[model samples]
Target: MSGIVDLTLTYTNDVAGFSKEASKVLDVDGWNASTLTFYSHCGTHMDAPIHFNVSNQTIDEIPVSNFVGKAWVIDARHVGSKGLIKPEHIHQDIKDKFVAGDGLIFWTGWSKYVNTPKYRDELPRISEALALWCIDKKVKMIGVEPPSVADVNNLDEVTKIHQILLKGVVIIEGLTNIDALQTNCVELIALPLKIESGDGAPARVIAIEKYL
Candidate 1:
């Protein structure tokens, strides 16, 4: 109950632009291998500042250290469908000590709807106020259970939120399995592919629970 929790969603053919084909078999090619292809922003992924044209720094240009941080797992399961997470929803402890380089996560329990339309169409997202709060607090990254932090349909709303946070905060979306985390705090490790000039990329996100 107190171990690392994998927070990344496994990519599948159901997801857009994701495909896998057996390229070699043990009997045929004397080895086993598959050709995997997926979109850059597929499944669990990180957004770079260049994603919204906030900055020219690509995903690979961002230092690896920025992907790891002391993250606080906020209980966000109460967030309603198509709701906004405002400043008050944040725990006081996180707000009080949310210094730069710290990470924040929303455990919204939305991953259960993966592959369903609800997963993307009716997600709880951070409000513009909350986005500014994250900037003011100078958080290193923000992880969410939904595919995107804002409504994918609302181009203006989604763009505004992403641009605001992507100015500095690393945005990790499509997170899963935070409900299994025993501790509220964790050492978050998110590693993404070093795609040249990539605006975003899939990442292997995990949470190492802090045992007391």
Candidate 2:
């Protein structure tokens, strides 16, 4: 198997509420350094329960082990713009194969449109049933290629879905490389920045095939 597949996005000025500036430069400031400013939820990130008031726990409070686990990338490429990813969209093979405590990666191939408005404004959202399904099945984590798991434009939809999922699941968004996986099963390792009381923070997520 190939060593690993990086599933996170590179933060840049193009992303909303994200900025970078040279705080110091070699030869001029005797050191080379830069300052990064971004929203807690910007780019590839993980959401804590407190993000939706599901609990008082922050991203830092979540056990790091919860972010690392066996994962299965369910095919969601057919779930297009403004579409809903229903439970039926998740095939029976994946449902039967992945037991509790395994991460589920929804491969919507949305990352290809990152620079386009459709990436955010018209994302394929996870339906309420699907959110509950993950919780009912006791999934360890659910990663998605979209910036959000629900319609950001719909307050009720986004909040409800997040609240339900955040109650028990680790959510990783803005993933990019799931499409490159040669197999549906993978070992997911996602690590978030340890920001104190952070609602969410950018993460570096990767997939390994050797485990399977």
Best by TM-score: 2
lDDT of 1 by residue, 1-212 (tens): 44788998988888765788899999989999999997888789999899999989999999998998899888988987998998899889877867778899998999999989899899999999999988988889899999999999999999999999998899999999999888888999999989999999999999988642
User: Could you give me the TM-score of model 2 versus the true structure?
Assistant: 0.97
For each candidate, what is the lDDT?
Answer: 0.90, 0.91
TM-score of each: 0.96, 0.97
lDDT per residue for candidate 2 within 1-212, as digits (tens), equals 45589998998889886899999999999999999998988889999999999999999999988988999888988878899998898889988887999988999889999868888899998999999999999999999888899999999999999999998999998999887788888889999999999999999999998655
Off by over 4 Å in 2: none
Query: How many angstroms is residue 158 displaced in model 1 relative to the true structure, after the best TM-score fit?
Result: 1.0
Clash pairs (backbone) in predicted model 1? none
Clash pairs detected, candidate 2: none
The local lDDT score (0 to 100) that residue 89 gets in candidate 1 is: 90
